[model samples]
Target: MITRSVQTVQTNPDDIIDIRQKIAGSWQEILSQAVTNPQELLDILGLDQALLPGAVVGSQQFQLQVPHTYIARIRKGDPNDPLLRQVLPIGEEMVITPGFSFDPLGEKPKNSHRGILHKYQGRLLLMPTQLCGVNCRFCFRRHFPYEENTLNREEWLSAFDYIRSDTSVTEVILSGGDPLALNDNRLAWVVEELAKIPHLRRLRIHTRFPVVIPQRITKELLNWLTGTRLQPVMVIHCNHPDEVDADVADAMKLLRDHGVQLLNQSALLKGVNDDADVLIELSERLFSCGVMPYYLHLLDKVQGAAHFEVDEQRARQIMSGMSDQCSGYLIPRLARENAGASGKVVIAPLYSLKI
Candidate 1:
């Protein structure tokens, strides 16, 4: 079981005010004032001083950036909070594990263009921004060279030209730190440009914006997302049931009403939603919010996140447990991504006891 330090400190008043101010505004406003300091995050949650040293160390590798809106869902003073575990940096991150690397997915080599990753046939990734509202500790792209990949206006046109050149490319995936991190005006222009491509049939957005900052689902965002002729599909990243609150539900409903196909994908973290009960409830909660359960991903073996990994045998066992209780449609496919593999490999759960 995951545990934390015993020493606790009083919540800082200035921190409270800063968080409150960030909480009450447009999504951009909230994101702009995101809690970046490790001390500030620990202070806000009333966590122990023991966590600060490791957090400081981890944040140095990849800066801590959590929106106040998302922090609102975490349980104050509890070190074992599932939602907190996803964002909190820890001492284990320093441990050097074999088979773990900076570019685990081998995305660096596949980055064919400035912002394009054409790993698979028929579909290509178009990264528009290098920003995310909340940075999950286990993100595979934590060490990705965003500076090299982020596109300018001319570069975006170059990317479109590449897509047009490849007539086989039918789908364009908007990925990044998170594509929704870009403002609607820029996003709409990107979509409009994509729509101009004769071969493109769908626009898939992989984002955590709606989950972390519900207010990001604005009227203008919806207008562009649905206005284009290309079919819009959004795959949101949510690991636990608590992540999907009433506000998240409303954001999802807005998307569904706008005809966006909603699906969810989660990393199977050791202490966060690794149990069968939590996974079952998460599926039910997602269904209530109009999103279908999609992929339950095995942790990507990134350098700093080996602590979050659940080995395949254990993952299969947990999925088998979920299979026993949940209906077929509610259960997500258990999948893993390999660097050179054509696509995600689906792993079927253990169904019967061996002799």
Candidate 2:
């Protein structure tokens, strides 16, 4: 069983504020403040040996990195831990493969405008920031050229101009390392600029901060999100249900109360949340907190993440098991992203054939 630290609270949103204020000065800051070096992060979590092994002193040392906020949420000394599986780097495979180029998804080639990726029609993904609270081991964009993609003030203006130029593009997705990592002032500024584009209908933010650092969902952040003219959508990256705690649930409630749609996109990792029961429980917990389970993505064929890949057959079986137990809404669509494909390819169940 996955063990977690629990806290109780009343239904009132003010009560949530009271809880946060009480812990504001004392509470640990994970990504933005506490964690600095990769090795020191390991010592804090007491995961130096289990994850690193003999490679600790070698030229290529395997490191155990977890944000203090994330570490605070974990039940200590559980090897089967899901959250640990995401951040702890194990010495498994090091050799690089041919097809796993820096730009596996062809993001750079498809960029029509600076700070914008126009892969799909009717929408443009604007990489507002190139920083995330915590870096996932299986990130497909681990090697993405962030230096080339960072947008300056004039560059952002040009991106907005491109959005206004094309009426077909109705949605603007604010993504990056994590959009919420930006302070309220910067986030509000970007939103204000996007609001001027008359053609944009929906504004979506893809972030992992709410799951990793729940304290980031401040009242000021919610005010800007709801105050916008375009419909606001937040897609949170959460691989395991254990990552969602009372703090995270409170954050989601704040957004839901102020008319922001909440959705989750989970990645299927071999040792992390590949089990059927874990996936089912994740869906149930997400629904209870008003966040819809959207997609269970297969691990992208990234070079460093080859250790996290489960075979295609095993993945399909897990999906089938989930379908039998949960409602269709709770069961997320199982899919994979093929390089240069028009859209995400859904993985269908296998059928037996006899000749």
Candidate 3:
């Protein structure tokens, strides 16, 4: 009798086309050393040892999750580093602020079926996995009970049945703790199933992998992604310009070269990207790297992340400034994800078009 581990999901090397032959096995090495423990993360970034206890408490449930690829981008010994601010499990995260609830987006009510989040019309979100490559403290779904929603083989069939019955679902969005966390074979299967629905015309993947772990953009992944029938669009998340390095630019280029449209959305974190100058730099850097600015999101008021919030008035001012200097295409929509709202509630509209 033979047994297999969950990590070792058997995938055929033949199914992996062109590029996979050249660079076959390297992600595992990166994954093995990904920052999971509190002390290792602090030591690597040269953050103060005194901050560890608070981080441990804050990350007790969610825990510290960061990739070595991402850590290298952070300025070592700087507690106030923007990249560190995004991932560091500080003591402030332990203090639950008022009016902040667990499910900030109200996704629980919108989950129409298992493994499905039908929030907006025409497009619905699918959870291929409940895990993210790097778990940011400010994630809207930090408190999402993904264990209950994790689908098995049989549950996946029911999810398929629900989608097949509804012709209105023309687009299937792969959202998760991060959809790109799933292996190429598993993700290919999910996309293939979505393509089977005749009404589905677009496949949108909401992930942070290309920013945090550029290595994730391998030939095998692209092969599975490009092989799909559904038109592919990847919405990558990047809050700061510094996150985009040469390697990241190359990864985005590969995706763009392969015909995948790339767009980016950023959270308006209080420390990370609040200033107009920082936001401007972020937009400029993103464009240079072939990624268009999609949305400059107002922070979601989740329980453990209130410290990162910037006032709506300040947020509009930043957008207004970006409007004044940058091209219209460079400016992103100022949107907020309000619970029970049909779509993203547009707080500040884009600048009026000049004919």
Candidate 4:
């Protein structure tokens, strides 16, 4: 229905394949061009107008942002498309579900430094920016007070001081809206600073950029990522197999080829990837891309995202099924983040219950 003059190809005249254009331009340019309008997204996907009302309301609460590269992967006109379900603003987000709070992980109390979250024992999290390529509707930090946590160049010194004082800290995690959201120069400076600390041994980045905008993994980005002495580990968030395509595969290969370890962490969302078969395929896809399955997180109980949560029992059952179908290395550990916990709590599968 909608056509654009980009480097994409469209075949299968009966299917909605017009949006499949090659995504070019700088990552920043593509990021700036993300589709924020609910109507525009509906038009591009050939979705019905009836869903617009809910989308408008949901976007009002948490602005809708999805990159064209990611949008092209969703099955047009399919409201329940797994890829679409993750980003599509829906009325259910406005509901006040019980037990779902604005701060599910109690991160505010853990904000030890200007932009640092020292929740775990040996590692700390730094938030340099509050930007992401795509804003998933089920984000636990949807209501996070990013303003209080974001740090400028000078402000980072205080965080560095905090880490320097704590010799026990051996790893630093770059997290936020997504650390990759920051430009290479900024990210390089941050990594360089972390590498200066004699105690820091590894630098982990948690981001969704590779899935949303694979082009984010540019040569300059690779230079900073691999140049650092601290071991680089990228934990990418990908829920469904549909999110991985040729572009994403290439990006992952680049990171791996450059000696940057690649790992995937997925959320056990209700409609997005609840079935055993879907999770199995996702793990296989990730392995083929040179990434190992790491964590299958039980959805964080954040306000407005209760609809996405899968119960602990069901999560364990799904893990059991994955263990049965896939190799041990391909199966991710089932984990959850409890407030004030020492570290991520791993949930044992149902089959392991008898043992």
Candidate 5:
């Protein structure tokens, strides 16, 4: 049995329990819940063998940890479901490839300052927290050096200094495991520090917490988010339409109501939402909920995520189908991030065969 500290709890366990209690303290509520134990989560998704190889005994006893909010959102009895796709670890494809690496983005090399990743011009990525509600199997940053990237108060202040020193930077992006994973107090402090930098005009937060764990969107979170000096933009990650339920809708509405511009970036995963119909519905749902469909990203060529990759030709076809059905606004930019590239490259559809 592998023993570890409970600090790795995805969503705050106490907060999750409290939210469940507040909604209704019923056994049915508890039973219908998604994987609360880590082992059970692995079993439901069939990730035990993939994650921990050669470890058979006491594996069943291991409790798979799933946050109550994320659990509440999952459709029952469907293991291959799209909502389950993001969190569940399948088999390891990491061993097969040599090129697929831990830091494909070269984030460590670009770490100009503490908590700051200055890879491109005019924008900087700040790593505020090293935690996320659900660990996506295809995450490019899954192997990121979270322990090394953590910033202390002085280090955080120094990051602001780095930003202020660079006159070209206009945008500051908060990202890590997920910026929303940090408590309101910590987040607000970071925001306040960034606000001090006169050149940093826009603040962008990339997070999946609001979609996966809606309870994290407390009123206090909204207040601090909206009250900030920088123009706040929240890019939420949601791939499928089914992922958007009433609770998620409420959270999105709250963010929108508070003058936080909302956008969505989705990855094209194999079992998740590869179909044109699924993509169309997801875009429509996002538009209806006051979020602009920003970018439909091709899966990053990570090792274990080879299962999720759809080839360029098929992706282009899907994009073309989406264009014919949905309004132009609803059609997201089909793009891919080339390693060491300045910005995401938009992949245009092929016109005709030239044999």
Candidate 6:
């Protein structure tokens, strides 16, 4: 197997619980202290030996990344837990499916601007950082050439100037490798620069930081978030209700309290949140936590995550069933981003304006 050796986690009981106590105060320290090792995650959860080798192999291709706050929610010893399934790297990831490719959404061709991606008209995606708080196993951008896109001070200034010249671009989206992974000062600087552009009407941030590491919702992060002149919108991602514990809810609520419009998008993953019941629960939970359901994304056909994809027919069925049980606002649009498409095509059947 083409894999690098992972440092073993010292499973002595004190060391296990000690890190948890130490990470209590600061989200910066918590992010700095995310658990990247597969064995350390397994040891903490008390998982069995049967799952180890596959996890080790998969981690090499896309390293296992889950913050302690997110891990604490998983039910110990249950391999099928929704949260675990999303983060755990299993043997199935090694298979190269016929249809799946490195650039599933055709993003490589859309690299028209430095550190900027123009997929849909009127909006551009700015990737200030190629880092994330938690590296989700099924992420479509798993193979993204982020290293090449890492823009320095002058490059970013050039990119910002590029945005200023594009009169048609009205929305600036901050995506990543989860954009919120950047420190408050760094993100603030970018926001301040972007706010000067007169054409931009909205500053949309697509992130998973608040959910994975609730402590990431610090006051310094909020200062720029609220201070920005552009209309601030946050698109958070969460696959299952279990992922939204009390801490996650509080973090989201902090954003809500600060006037950041909260919206959520989730990928429809097999064995994770495919069930109608699960979808319904997730929607209701999301609404209670101050987020409106935005998109139920059909899995982006990317390599290593074909196992997680649910077919279009089945996806529609699940959405239909969810519509029957959930309130209209809670029912997210079932959307797919076909390569080279102008926008996400909504295919969720029987979806009407009326609840």
Question: How many steric overlaps are in each model, in order?
Answer: 0, 1, 0, 3, 8, 0
Better of 3 and 6 by TM-score: 6
Instruction: Give the worst 10-residue stretch by lDDT in candidate 6.
Output: 12-21
lDDT (Cα, 0-100) at 165 in candidate 5: 94
> Pick by lDDT: which candidate is best?
1
Instruction: Sort by lDDT, best first.
Output: 1, 4, 6, 3, 2, 5
Global Cα lDDT for candidate 6? 0.87
Better of 2 and 3 by TM-score: 3
Candidate 2 TM-score, C-alpha based: 0.88
Q: Each prediction's Cα RMSD?
A: 9.4, 5.8, 9.1, 7.1, 10.4, 10.2
The CA lDDT at 317 in model 6 is 84
Q: How would you encode candidate 2's per-residue C-alpha lDDT over 189-276 as one tens digit per residue?
A: 8899889888898999999888887777877787889898989999999888888888888888888888989999999998889998
Off by over 4 Å in 4: 1-23, 352-355
The reply for model 6, stretches above 4 Å from the true place, is: 1-23, 351-354
lDDT of 4 by residue, 13-96 (tens): 212111222337678888999999999999999999999999999999999999888899999999999999999999999999
What TM-score does candidate 4 get on C-alpha atoms?
Answer: 0.92
In angstroms, the error of model 4 at 193 is 1.3
CA lDDT scores, all candidates in order? 0.90, 0.77, 0.84, 0.88, 0.74, 0.87
| Tens digit per residue, CA lDDT, model 5, 29-81 | 33245354445655554543444441222123222235656655566656667
Model 2 is weakest, by summed lDDT over 10 consecutive residues, at 54-63
Which ranges of candidate 5 are over 4 A from the true structure? 1-21, 24-38, 42-65, 350-355
- Whole-structure CA lDDT of model 3: 0.84
Model 5 lDDT, residue 216, Cα: 72
Off by over 4 Å in 1: 1-23, 352-355
lDDT of 3 by residue, 229-331 (tens): 9999999999998999876887787788788999999999999999988988988988887899999899899988999999888898888777777788888
- Work out how many backbone clashes candidate 2 has: 1
